[model samples]
Target: MTSDRMTPEVLWSMGRIGTFNVSPDGNTAVYTVTYYSVEQNKSHSVIYVLNLNSKAQTLLTTSPKSEYSPVFIKNGQKIAYLTAESGTSQLWEMNVDGTDKRQISFEKDDISEFLFSPDEKLLILIKEVETDASIAKNDSDLPKASGMVINNLMYKHWDTYVKSIPHPFVARFNGDRIEDSTDILEGEPYECPMMPFGGIEQLSWSPDSKSIAYTCRKKTGKAYAISTDSDIFLYDIATKSVKNLCKQADWTEQPCDTTMSLEHQAVNHQQKDNNVGYDQNPAFSPDGQRIAWLSMERDGYESDRTRLCVYEFATGNKTYVTEKFESGVDQFLWMPNSKNLCFSGVWHGKTQIYTTNLKGDVKPLTDEVADFSLVSLAPNGKDIFCKKHSMKQADEVYLLKGNKLEQITFENKHIYDRLTMGNVEERWVATTDGKKELCWVIYPPHFDATKKYPALLFCEGGPQSPVSQFWSYRWNFQIMAANDYIIIAPNRRGLPGFGMEWLEQISGDYSGQCMQDYLSAIDDLKKEPYVDEEHLGAVGASFGGYSVYWLAGNHDKRFKAFIAHDGIYNTQQQYVETEEMWFPNWDLKSAPWIKNAEGQMQKAFRESPHLYVDKWDTPILCIHGQRDFRIEYTQAESAFSAARLRGIPAQLLLFPDENHWVLKPQNGILWQRTFFRWLDRWLKPDNK
Candidate 1:
């Protein structure tokens, strides 16, 4: 085989090239380069600048420290990025030539998202301030007797939990000086509504640099903080006053119990549109006269109807464009001239980019794009800069001109090196929602076409996520394939590439339909020759964790075993007790789930696998970190107790200092080893 056929050392590398920012002249582009070493089973990132004019690339930073999200600032001579080294993440800005590297933020410790302003005058970074609410008077500091007998769900789902740690405000990227800056909107450790995390996301400075507009989440609650709704917020620099641009819905009066919504499934789903709240991605019109954004007429988790509202700042006049257009709009950009706008949204399940004028004249701009990212038209409106990920590759940046598509990066050129072409097959199946789901089938190291083998199904949990089709070191289709298991992974519904309906559909009913969808995907796999249904098992984390529980209860007889890393089993209780009040706040309708516990309990109880422990007999594995602030350890504890009460097979594993997503390297390897061991014991072809 030619060297070209062999994946390049540089090509077969890390995570992804993200945070693409074009230079002012559009000749130089800087993007993030990431890769995860499987042997190391760790993630590393760096910044690279690619020059279109010279066809040259410059890689920055020295070894040991990973830099990400590089962008040209201060007239394109310097770039600002977030760097993680020495166990701390802080702001750093350096010259284009990689000299004069200086640390900007002086936080003793932090993880932040930062950007240089359009004018390059100030640097803005989102800092997560960890406050120890250890409660000096807590029952004890010597670790309580947490030895709850393991249950089937914990063993089957591989469930885990962590103490609630503070989450930084969402979408709260402020325009502040990185060196010595005042926070625009920061999460107060003890705030009730955890709306800050995404409050300032999708932000763009007004052309005049006078103010900023962003989407903010505010939940009216007395219990920990939850965002009953998200709305548009306008912050004026001069007056330093933050104005709530929309009316606040009386969520309190109605009660926020997840179960008791009077609205029908469809009605509850469309709740984002009611006057109470509506909107995301607030972008200022190029001319600064108007702002265009997405607003849900109905604001439920799965509701699909959203409008493009053009707000005239001066006159306070609002005009709704694309009225009742339900296909979800994922991303939008102001056509350089601001006369026309280009946005990427879903239509019939596939993500397609559309261009429209202020009058609402819309046209399907691209026909062949199955998935799209970075949907901005070139300054001339002649082309759009986007990364199009096909079944063949994860994502690639493409320049869509008048009649042709130009590939901008060759990042994935040798992604499939060393793998036989015939062994890598792409499969498509229908998800629970009737949308077409895509999956990649990788045969074992020496796969025989006619042979059947045990298969492993891996699911990733996120509102708009896929099972990670791209190459990875720790876990990917290829990694699983090497482990002697046919990886029958599916990119199920509710992923961004599919569009808004599928993405939003799984919102409120996270454990509801999405869980069923996982079951459907496995059922579909059973029909394939290469898959062995009788020897099937599944693994997922976070949202995927919730699904494992949902599936374990509803479809335990289907799998030999299960693993749910950081899964939530008891939603009714989890809805209130979790640390980051915001998750429960946003997921649940209001707060004090106990208020409607009678009905909410019935809803969660009906859905919770823990409530129906009698149905679970499958071996399960549960994992959690005592320090996790996202979903508390009690969730898994509550789940484990129920599993054992019913005398189901279960095992519980606890990490004293880990969080939502395992970060400690030593523990990650341990978790993965234990998880796969449990899988091998149950799903191993030889074991049987």
Candidate 2:
């Protein structure tokens, strides 16, 4: 029987594919697939290999322990991956045909990530080393401490404490057994790949395999508290020496000049103290003549535009390759020919792949409305392998052969064939200031123009990030539409894509034009004959959650209910409490209590959600995770308490183990169920 509607279970059952690497010959590709079991309430990943010629796929690894980051080595005849089969995650290798499996690295600590050298004789690995003074590297070495003695600002990160710092190590494979291991980043007070959300992309190997380029912040102790100045460093294997590739001249100790503006002086002083600005995702050219990486201008601003830069090895000069490109360059890879580079960035509400030459001439390689993440480029430089996804389909591996694109994997086909997905369309609504804002509207499944449906306006979290036409595992719109609710996601001002000016408009004044833009979109959405304006509701997470709170207080009568997940309750508190101080500092223009021109407090503090609690009368569902350090759990507690104190219907969903996002398989289902039930309670009373 054909499936009638898509449910949370079906979405969870489908395999989630990630990170593939093509063989040197480009004839085979190895990728990882993760599947979750609801009964076990856990997920495990396995590696698979696909033949590009015959489109035949074979399972390579079937270990109960999860295996990930599969890459071809030994002249494309062997594969290597990371697994915890021996307790801690260690490097494992096997033949191309899945035979002769053997463990490679036997380090006491688990290897976080590893990459093969171009010659395949050596491996570059990143592992965690205990940095906390009280914690012993080996548990048996010393008695266990009951409590952690904190000495630094970054003692605790997003979801875990700073027990260890990530360091890079080099190991040589002597054909029989791996030997000659060395820690390259031992003395430096730097974390390669930088915390929170960094992976193998932060490290790059030169074509000759003699030098490795990696990104790291040199700041230590109290200096790391307010600065995010990271730079690319080149490490030589033979000499064991490191040199900063993007270091700037000393400027921190300069006397205050009366001619310079205060803002300019402050920025220069910060950079002088921090040295190099934020640089990440280093990619070495095929010939090893130059290196390309992403660089940000300001020192303490994490939201600054990421411009692409190239550093020449011979001249020791750096040049900006994407100065004219308005959008930030997120990821890029050097072409096999070493003359061109392929990158993925947000453009007009969608992430597309583009190619740029050394001289800065850029051309769009893929212009589809869907989002595309570049996986690997063919060795011949003729085919591009990418993972593409849209609102109607989950992410699947696709091969771009010349102008023709062919889907190579059917991992999600079983789920896709049975899903009755809604019709998705992009609409532009006029804002109050005569500006047009983009919004994506997903009509309910089996939608009828003559029938009215309750609308759910989804507030995208980034405030700076866009709600692109991409598939989301957590906030899947198809499942919502299957439940007969119209989904509307608006790309308000401050969201990426429509240009930097539009993105910066909502910085200091988050509740100003951006809020009006959301309101305008809702008003325009209400004009549709199929929209049920009386039962409309709003939902958001992070910045989006902040928007929902703002709406509850100011536009309470319009939205029947509001759902804020891990939102900010008080802006002033968020500035100090958040782990990354650069975000709030850049957005608010200064620290809290700093006055603007009129001698008033910063706009961010003045427009905090906590101050307008008296006006919040609408029912609200607040969700928070205890481990969410980005936006503390107290934000949700305060919001839920305020609503209850005001005698308004309120509910709180707390996840003790989860972080900012509800990532666990069972918790994800519970979150979805709770979300739908809350909407049903207020928006669709008859259905309840």
Candidate 3:
């Protein structure tokens, strides 16, 4: 019999739920459930329609191919979705009750994402078009030549080499067929939806359906790689003209006074509302009089505060709504009344829903300890639906009607029922810097204070990502606890949900106070008699991975084992190898050779993990994906090699086909098994 505790196999067996769309009448919702098959080593998504009133659900599609992005169309009488039954993804429509299914689009290229206009007479579809001539044209000339002639800076991004770019096409739909399609970007080399994670979220149609607001950086090559200055563009469908909605007053037409230093020139440029940083995910109000989007103030700081900015189309006036929120907005939706908007922002240690009006008054709507994200509002606008998840449970749809929240979906109820979850307790410990830090302590299932349990220090990546009540498949706190180990995840000096000062402290100070914050959390927890202080371990990926490597040399015999995944081993090597130059330049404060005002480079490179391998005494497991261009796999290999050379008992788990994340099912399982196997060896000596 399988253990009643949650395991890697049980974790993978559970179904995952995605975001959903509500019908126009708000009485029903359509969502997708994704299930992974270990035997097939793949995952498939199936769409389902649920009556919001009666809590009745009906599976809509059963085709072998996955059907997703279901939306109610034709006045809630029909449902439209995308499927790949014809070998290439295309638009398909069906009756609301799951009947009269038929293909509606026959475009040559695959339709990655689509959105119908408010009137349902127009449609916008996202398709990958070959824009880079040198990459695609030359490839056809030499079909077998594997060599790529690189001439641009953004030639490669994330995991794949840049070739085809996704563009939005506006076409007229006459119920059965789409006609007179026009590429909004036309022949421009820029991507409308952006790359990697962006999709339909980057584009929003006006209520009048006469114009489309899209997010695009409009830069290529080196310019694109060094900046995060994407702007929101308003494209008029009838006039075939585009205008930059976030453009400042004559900043582009007026040349900057270049006599000053580059630093001084940037400061001068900041005087205007140039919207220098990322301005994306435009959402037009239901009335079509105003448009709002998530905007970041800094040019290269991707982790900058994402303020909600609203722009009035008539007056061309912009208001920074939610300025009082302090923290950043994750997602927002305009209320049906158009006077108020609901948004989700992080505060303390949880993401909660808040409402803000045009006058900038913010009010908390829900204050649950768990994170709540805005999904869709009811037709009445008073009732809202959100996706809520905690450290112990995965995502599930919840309906918020005033003070009452009802669970609308139970995608993994079966798995959850059979297993017992550990207790997640939030504790605030005093940091070495004379500040209080929040750390979540998760005990093993049926934990007893009489017995000693091994503990793990969970360092977070993004260096700026939140250590909130997040439910992640890879870094799940519950799974670690299920293995009879205590987990201490800290919202260190660099993590969000604390405040801006805390979040920005990690930048240019990777091995500084944030490191102390991690130590403080573990040190405080290890003092507990129930914790096995001698067998502590540190594990993280990306920036967190960098933390593990740094801690290994400087942990002072505090930890017995270390696991670093796709972490930065050498600061000098990472500066040149990484695709995005802005990330390292901002975080490290300068290039490897150049010295900043504070001489951060000297201190940053001086403390690189590769430099302090002499102090490593603990066993380590380094896992990395070869395709992780953000932080190359070579970082992990170098760490692993240095450990083995020092005879510190190291293991390297490399995936050539994977990226920064172990996405494949089989690889994920292997990762979990190897992770526990290594931990059990050093941390649980008795088990070995």
Candidate 4:
């Protein structure tokens, strides 16, 4: 029976709330509500509109359609989004009142992601294709016209084994029906050496709708699972003419090694050529007088310190808006007046929103509000929407500086206050072997000084990811804590938010010193009150999955259980077979991507938990998504097979159709339900 003492609401809420969009007046915002039901073993998200002025809400469409990426078109009167109907996500639009909804495109393609131009005249949706032929590894043919494969050397540098989603074209919508779905880009092999079509991206449109800027990913070799180089291009719909913008700037961002991620892009070119500049996140001033884009590479490397440049169309002069070393601004938006740039930045471990003038002089808008950053600027420009999340609470959209974070909605408000943080405090910990490494730790929740409870260490995805954090009482650590488990989640090396230096710490060394750091967090937490060293457990997914394999095998007695989800067991295989074939490709450049290579063997073994499998005796639960493009299914299969051979009592759970991150509501509930069942069996909560 479900325990009355259980506060699973926190877990349900964590699975629910996420950023959707802001209203026109900025006084209101929209977000999604995701909930996981243990009984049904499912998780679902429904769109919600928040009134910051009154802390009220209105639910939008609610069904298994998985309506997502809700963007405001003309305030909230219309929302352009992608939803599932016939098993494939397609572009759809609906009015504010939730009426007049219709599917926008009939293209026989799976709509993965999309964005609406500010003017609302155009909508760009990312499309993926399926075929009878096995997905290929080499670049030979460009996906031209229809049904052709997209080729260009630019794909060579990316995570090899990308999904076969090619030949993305931009379609102009007249009302809901598309008027033009044209191939605005093509390969100019003579100079660019690329077939222009591969990954469909959100093409940036000028505020005046005169021009669109995009990057044609090109450049290959030395890495996979990531792009090597891409050059931005300009398209003028009126003249039907296209030009390569980077051809004049010729920027080259070299691969040193670091983990800074927003989206898993096909390619991001670093500006190296003095004449050529590389930029991302193009924005035209509201008046459409000037264009502003990021100069992504600073001093031969992708610096957190990037440059913001504005080009005056009338004079053709480029102005470096910010004289300071800066760029890669998050949630950036231009003021309606077009005079100031509003963006969020990380300063001393805090993510805060700041405003900068056209010249780039900056000042913080929200202060001492940890992890508070601008979410959206209302279409009408009357209010600004932001989310404030702290160590103690799951993130919530708040009305800034007006009435103390007008808690936009009431959904999960109580969970934060109801949560028992215990003596578990947050601390930044670092360890080193070759370079300075950074990690974050949350001491056991409700940690008592006298009693000893089982300790669980979580090894999260290392690249382009932060160890999962939720302000709710339902985070894994918190949930485990509710069961008298002392939990420790480490940021570990090669994590984002930290500078490039820290993120690149694990470059050629995936599991070496950093693995020890995770173990160390366990050892350190073990010494604390209410922690049991003998009952230690570890869990992770993706790269963390590799860590689980590494840990389970090397020191079988160290953990009671190791939950490895979609982990990488065979490095050599992943580099070749995984659909998002970038992981294995990139790590090989740091060292030989071989099984028993001498110089790198020690470090490789440390990173690869599967290498120590012969000695593994710990009980482990392995989970995987059947359709995962990132880590691939073989990762789970090999590890589970190895465990069975070794008689380690390893359990396996596979979800068909689920990707790297389970998106379906039911799957999400099933994941947590199954996860907790395994936990209860292995690390049974004392609370029960």
How accurate locally is residue 485 in candidate 2, as Cα lDDT from 0 to 100?
85
User: lDDT winner among the candidates?
Assistant: 3
TM-score of 2: 0.95
How far residue 546's Cα lies from its native spot in candidate 4, in Å, is 1.7
lDDT for each residue of candidate 2 in 68-154, tens digit (9 for 90 to 100): 988887788888888987789988889887899999888888888998788878878888876753233445555665565566666
**10 residues in a row with least lDDT, candidate 4:** 188-197
Q: What is the TM-score of candidate 3?
A: 0.97
User: Which candidate, 2 or 4, would have the higher TM-score against the true structure?
Assistant: 2
Residues 240-352, model 1: lDDT tens digits: 67775554344333445443332343434434434333477788887888888877654333244556777777877667666545455667778867778777765533466
Deviating ranges (above 4 Å) for candidate 3: 133-136, 253-269, 596-600
For model 3, residues 26-123, the per-residue Cα lDDT tens digits are 88899999989988999999999998889999998999899999999988999999999778998999998889999988888899999899898998
Question: Whole-model Cα lDDT per candidate?
Answer: 0.60, 0.83, 0.87, 0.59
Every model: Cα RMSD to truth = 7.2, 3.0, 2.2, 6.7
Candidate 4 matches the true fold with a TM-score of 0.75
- TM-score of every candidate relative to the true structure: 0.74, 0.95, 0.97, 0.75
Q: List candidate 2 segments past 4 Å from native.
A: 1-3, 133-144, 249-265, 268-276, 596-599
In candidate 4 the C-alpha lDDT for residue 78 amounts to: 78
lDDT score for residue 188 of model 1? 36
